[model samples]
Target: MRDAEEARTQPLGPQGRLGRGSVAPVLQLLSLALFTVVLVVILVKVSKVPSYQERRQEKQKIDKEMSQLKTGIAGLCRPCPWDWTLFQRNCYFFSQSKRNWADSVIACQDMGAQLVVIKSVEEQNFLQLNAKNKGPTWMGLSDLKKEGVWQWVDGSHLWFSLSNNWLPGEPNNDGDEDCAEFRGDGWNDGKCRVEKFWICKEPAASCSSP
Candidate 1:
């Protein structure tokens, strides 16, 4: 027995080859590599996220597209905007604020619409009924350009013989009244300098009612 201490050969592991000590190091290296790969994947995914400004811009673009879709040819199924009334396939807005005739015209134009255009007795009646509750309101009819020759905001001539929705003693052209106002009696030419609530009219989305 030559040196019993060295005679007891090191205990063998699986297959009695490299032993358990060598296996542990290999497993550790594999685990480290796997962890590194996972970390790298996570970093790359985080880097791909959009920035705050980029995300905001994208949202703004989507919002613009949605607005166009709501007002364009595809909007046939959509309804009138809020605070507007729908009648005869048209949308009418009754303003709560008061403004002079010129300013009222500007206000309506700013909203992508014009002052109410009363084309028929039916339209006049509709406006009259709606304005009954509200105070006196402004109409699109005016003779500012040429006295006694009334024209609509759309530049169409007003044919009194056709609709004839005017007060008996109105349009007297009293005190240089060029603008028109709608009252419970009928329409009357009023001073453009005087402020009054106005009505706005536009084509409603062509939605078929269920």
Candidate 2:
């Protein structure tokens, strides 16, 4: 009886005590899952590296092309009629002959040119310096459309305020002096019918845009 009781109290084989779990298999499975996640991350990084490299290479190519274009542009042929007096990168034709402002503009157009269109501070200064010394000279300015509001001959809004403002009480719009002229270190209304030296301007290239 004692022997039988001792035998029954003894533990059964390992299979009979399966309720107790082993950590080894669980640890191995978790390690495999973590390894799989790490492998995916590495693959994603490797896949993106080539794209980054390609983008960098494309940027470099663009930079190189821009540099080459700038270098080549420097030696590009300048516009024709290089003999024309170039002031501030613009060619000007100061009329030695006297003509009314409108007639002067028409003359310029006849020559495939336009009346001088002042565009910059340096240009205005240069024009003032190079113009006739004593007598008033007709410029590209006009107020025919809007009596008080002045505009360039090309219908562009005038921007040369500081360089060219009318002398105080000068642009009186007196019936006779409807045209404008640069005189007495400033602008003044003048007779468009009055013949006076004028200025003509041409594009660097005779080429017209479509």
Candidate 3:
């Protein structure tokens, strides 16, 4: 009886392996459950990557449909493509993908458009608001031909007096920043090779139906 009593009162050492009342096994089980829950969450996110991509594609399609022109018997009005945004009779394409300056120019050309040129104060204001919401975006301005002589993609010189929308002391050409981007404040010189979203501009497309 005394031996049994001593065993019952014995301090919990390594030899007193987990029993019903021991908290060690319970803690271990709780930790395993927590790990399982975290692992399951991670797996779920990984599995939904494709679904996220599909959802983005669907959203783009919906936007295109919503902006489509109304069909009429005599559809002679020039309108922007369903995917492009229209402003002041001009159609603009804000790229969803990021690319280097040269690649961005190629991308716009491929779409039968060119990188945007700020032709007026109205267009500048419009883009200022657009860029403020979209983060840093590349424009058609560059000084690749001659440093410090910025020109639009169309070979026209930038009129700084009329469109002096530079972010104070900008176009610094730091680290060979030959390309220009539209920021919240205005334009800034950026590295030509750095990947960034771009803007493309073109005349409104003529839509006709037989």
Alpha-carbon shift of residue 83 in model 2 (angstroms)? 6.4
Clashes of 2: 0
Per-candidate TM vs. native?
0.61, 0.55, 0.62
lDDT of 3 by residue, 83-143 (tens): 7989988999988889999999999999899989889999988987887788889999999
Model 2, 36-72: lDDT tens digits are 9999999999887768779999999999999999977
Q: Candidate 3's error at 181, in angstroms? A: 0.5
Model 1 CA lDDT for position 49: 99
93-202: candidate 1 lDDT, tens digit per residue: 99999999999999999999999887777777889887867878999989989989999999999875644677788779989999998878678789999999899999
What stretches of model 3 exceed 4 Å from their correct place?
1-78, 206-210
Clashes of 3: 0
C-alpha lDDT of all candidate models, in order: 0.86, 0.77, 0.87
Ordering by TM-score:
3, 1, 2
Model 1 root-mean-square deviation? 10.7
